[model samples]
Target: MSETTMNTATGATAARGRGAVALTVARVVLALFFAFSAFAKLIAHESAIESFDRMGWSHGAMYLIGALEMAGAVALLVPLLSGVAAMAFVGLLAGASVVQLTLLDPVNAIMPTLLIVLVVLIARDRQDSTAQLIALVRRRA
Candidate 1:
């Protein structure tokens, strides 16, 4: 090949490699973040309960959120289910962000940003279980 063509090919390969590295890094970071956040909530159940109470959620809701977080963490670690779990966690985080905003709760302002990132990562996984979830809902209706 000509020098120019070889250089172009080399650059393209380098760019693709960089993109792959970036994607892998992003996935690992997201996985670790969800895992750690969920573990923290599980390890500090009382603190989560107290915070939930202060936020005016019912006890049942508090327990439910905790359970979901724990489940999401486990799902994050499981390759077969990670995509679905990531989606669930994204929704949970988004809902919490909305509640915080509505209640004028400044404590979770950054949560929405994190949730957005999680949504992006989930999109990379190509599961699209959202469609299935919607279908299930429609069937019940």
Candidate 2:
């Protein structure tokens, strides 16, 4: 290959490397946030429980959401599963944002709404990987 071509290829490779690093870091941060929230709900922590109660939600609702959050958090840490996790988070956080706006403090809705944006970015970035995973599963099945 020509020297100029090699340099171009190297630059592209470096860019992709940086993108991957950024995505991985984002995933880690999201995992931490969701895991913390999940534990609070699962443990019936004072603040978490009170928030649910104030919304007129039962214990079951709290537990169910907590479990789902925990699962998503775990999935976020796994490269293959992170895309799926991001997609799931978009849906979950959308519901949370709606509830926060309608049933709870409207201010509280900002966090979930922002998180939805972040997860959507992650989902878009990892779409190729997600498609590959689905393709592999289909081939196997």
Candidate 3:
């Protein structure tokens, strides 16, 4: 290949490598975040308890969210399930964002809003994998 062609090819490959690394990093960070959040709720942390009570949610609701958060964290690391997990987090985080903006300080909504954007990117990036998973399940059914 010509030098220009080789440079272009190499650059494209490098860009893909970077994209993969970014995706991996995002997944790990999201997993750790949700895991810790779940731990906080499961332990009945004072803030979590107060927040749930203020929201008119029962202890059961808190526990359910904690469990779901843990499951979503695990799912984020699984190749076939990462997209699914991200999609789920989009809704979960959206709800949390709304609650933050409406019930608590609007400033508290920042994290969940940013998380929603990240998960949206992750979901878009993993669209093909998610599609394949859906196809496999369809075939099995």
Candidate 4:
């Protein structure tokens, strides 16, 4: 191959590699954030219970939600795990936001909306990471 052609190919390859790295880093950061939140809820058992009670859910349901959140947080760290956990949290937050609005309370909805947006950003980053992984695999094989 000509020298100029080789340099162009090299630059393209480097660019792709950099993009993939950036995406992976973003995913890792997002996964860490979700995991940390879940861990906090689990660790502060009493606080979670209190939160559930305040929300008007039965104590049993509160425990269940805490467990679910922990599970979802762990799932976010695993690649190719169907992303169900992340999706579940996203839905939960979105629903909470709507309920907050229905109750004619603004504060109840704002935080949930923020949380939902964070989840969506994580999901988008994850999707980009997955696409890059697939492309790399295809390039190799």
- Say which candidate scores most in lDDT: 3
Supply candidate 1's per-residue lDDT for 91: 80
TM-score of each: 0.63, 0.87, 0.94, 0.56
lDDT of 2 by residue, 1-141 (tens): 999999999999999999888878999999999999999999999998899999899989999999999999999988778888999999999999999999988998999999898899889888887888899899999
**TM-score of candidate 3 against the unseen true structure:** 0.94
TM-score top scorer: 3
Task: Provide the clashing-pair count of each candidate structure.
Answer: 0, 0, 0, 0
In lDDT terms, how accurate is model 1?
A: 0.68
Clashing pairs in model 1, backbone N/Cα/C closer than 3 A: none
Runs in model 1 with CA error above 4 Å?
1-10, 125-141
How much lDDT does each candidate structure score? 0.68, 0.92, 0.94, 0.66
Model 3 lDDT per residue over 29-87, tens place: 99999999999999999999999998888999999999999999999999899999999
Clashing pairs in 2: none
lDDT of 3 at 41: 93
